[model samples]
Target: MARITHGIACSHIPVLGYAFDHGKEGEAYFKPAFDGFGWTRQFMAEEKPDVVILVYNDHASAFDMKIIPTFAIGCGELYGPADEGFGPRPVPPVEGHADLAWHIAQSLILDEFDMTIINEMEVDHGLTVPLSMMYGHVDKWPTKVIPLAVNVVTYPPPSGNRCWALGEAIARAVESFPEDLKVQVWGTGGMSHQLQGPRAGLINKEWDNRFLDRLVGDTQELRHIPHIEYLRETGSEGIEMVMWLIMRGALGKSTKALHRHYHVPVSNTALGHMVLEPVDGTVPPSPTLEGNSAAAQARIA
Candidate 1:
């Protein structure tokens, strides 16, 4: 059966992509940020997962005001780069795992998590930047991807616990698949920094590090943090950190940190990255899809 081998969480600021695309890695301002992913590249090379479940938010690129899905999964054959105002980044098109994506969508719905299923959509920097950060300048992404877009742009995005629970559901779906595949789920965005308003440039290193600590072992406590606290303390944009919970939730209860890197001033955001693997070397038991759906139906009655 297919299984999620590990989880990854990182910041997906566009400036980091610009730096790598424009050959600014050697520059003083961006070197530290570039250096942060060195270990991740090495980790990917070693683990070599067959597919990646990329979790990120669309920045008004794919879904405009017309429609906003709190949770969307890509079930297309291919996805192209979106031109987010500036031109589209010069990156190869992303290949999607349509079969796995379809299975996940069906399973998640049966698990009582309604999700928007898309067969077509252009991906913005929020998705591509994280790929670039991990794989570097590849002609094509090294592995197939299942894009999971969370609605962080919309006010009152899914709560921390909701995202966490969704991750657990995804883990169950992945394990139930019959294919012999190795998969990794990634959550990208936020390390504290505000990109708008009078307090446009806010970076709280102490808060960011403490959050990382909680992610490693204290997620039970971290999952309870409210959205207002993240917004008020980390900045409006910093609320993006909630998306990280999805990746954390999918990894099961016990995880061993393989590698972690944190750096500041990557444009206006703090960059954080970490690799985590299940310590027990086995998938955890998750709520059965049929059971969950039945429970949901029972609640309505």
Candidate 2:
């Protein structure tokens, strides 16, 4: 059966993609920012995962106000790079693991977490920027990807605790799969920044680092944080941190924090990255309970 052995979290700022595409790696302004991902790239090379379950929010490219699913899973054979106004960043299309994706979709639904299944979709920077951050300029991504798009852009998005429980459902799904494969779940976005309104160009390094500390040292307490706290403390878009909880919950209850990188003023956002290898003997959720059940919540709590 497939097992999720590792978990990764990073901020997927569009400017990072721009930097990689424009060859700004060695430039004085961008060197420090780009250097933050050096260790992640080396780690990816040595780990060589077979599939990546990328959890990201679609930034008005794939889903607009017309319709948005609270949670969408891509189960297609391949996903092309979205043209986010500058012609798709000149990168190879993201390959998909349809068989595993379908299995996960079915499992999530059966676990009572509603999911919209997409046979075809184009991935925007929210999904690809993280890939570039870790893989650099490659002909194709190193491994297959299963895109999990959460509706953070839409108002009344899923709560932090709910996203965490959904992660447990995902773990149960991956564990039931018959294939012997290495899988990693990556949660992308937010370390505090507000893009518009009176609070534009915001970067709260103190809050960002505190959040990271709790995420690495005390994740159980971290999951209890509410959306209003993210909005008020981290800024309007800081709510993106909720998605990181999903990646955390997937790692069961314990982890070894391998690396942490934090930088500031990368465009309008603060960049954050961390890696986790699930500790052995961490308990997963009970398969008998519904994904959103109170008992399931306690497992994550």
Candidate 3:
């Protein structure tokens, strides 16, 4: 069976594309923060996983406000770069693991996560920015991928607890797959920053640190935090931390942290990244009964 070897979580700030395109790689806005994440390239190199199941949310770039899928899986052969207001990034297309994505979609639906199956979908900076950070320009990505896209843009998105539970479901799917391959599951976005509307450029370093701490040792408390509280306490539009629980769930109860990095810039968002490897004999924590129950009812309601 394919083993999900590790999980990587990160933030996908659009400014990185701007920095790359403008040839200002040395500018104060991007230099130090970019340098701090040097560990990412190293971890991917050492692990050299066979497949990477990337967990990220789409910006309105690919799927518009008109139709949103709470969870979507890409089974396409390749994904193109997105055109933000400025223009598309000059990057090669992203390739996918079709066989693995197909199996995952079947398994997740059987387990009742009810995801949208997409055979052809283009990934925006949300997936590519992190890919660039993690793998750079190889002839091909070091590892193939199964793209999981969550919906965080529209109102009444999936709950934090729901995202967490999906992580557990993903672990089950990965373990049950009948291949003997090493895999990495990556969750991207948010530490405590906001974009869109008047609340743009807000950062809460204190909350970001607390989030990292709780995410490691006390995720239950973090799962119980409601979406409104995240918006009110963090920022109106900065609830992307909901995606992090997916990585946490995949890692199960305890993990050895290989590395962690955090930075906030004037470019309108806070950036963070984490690398977690599961410890052997780590059992999956019992699903948060109350939170999952409430999420189920919300779906039904």
What tens-digit string does per-residue lDDT give for candidate 3 at 1-301?
Answer: 8777788888887777667656666787788777766777887787798888888889887799788999998887777777877677877777788877887777677667789988877778888888877875565777777889988878788898888888887787777677788988888878677766687777888888788777665346777779987897678656778888888887777777788888777376778888887775253633433357654333222
Could you tell me the lDDT of residue 113 within candidate 1? 88
Off by over 4 Å in 1: 281-301
Better of 2 and 3 by TM-score: 2
Model 1 clash pairs? none
* TM-score per candidate: 0.94, 0.94, 0.89
Residue 22 lDDT in model 1?
94
Clashes of 3: 2
lDDT accuracy of residue 2 in candidate 1:
90
What would the per-residue lDDT of candidate 1 be over residues 7-85, giving only the tens digit for each residue?
Answer: 9998998998888899998899888888878888988888898999999999998898999899999999999999988
Candidate 2 ranges with C-alpha deviation above 4 Å: 287-301
For residues 26-115, could you state the per-residue lDDT of candidate 2 as single tens digits? Answer: 998788888988998999999999999999999988899997999999999899999888787799999999999998888787667889
- Between candidates 1 and 3, name the one with more favorable TM-score: 1
Clashing pairs in 2: none
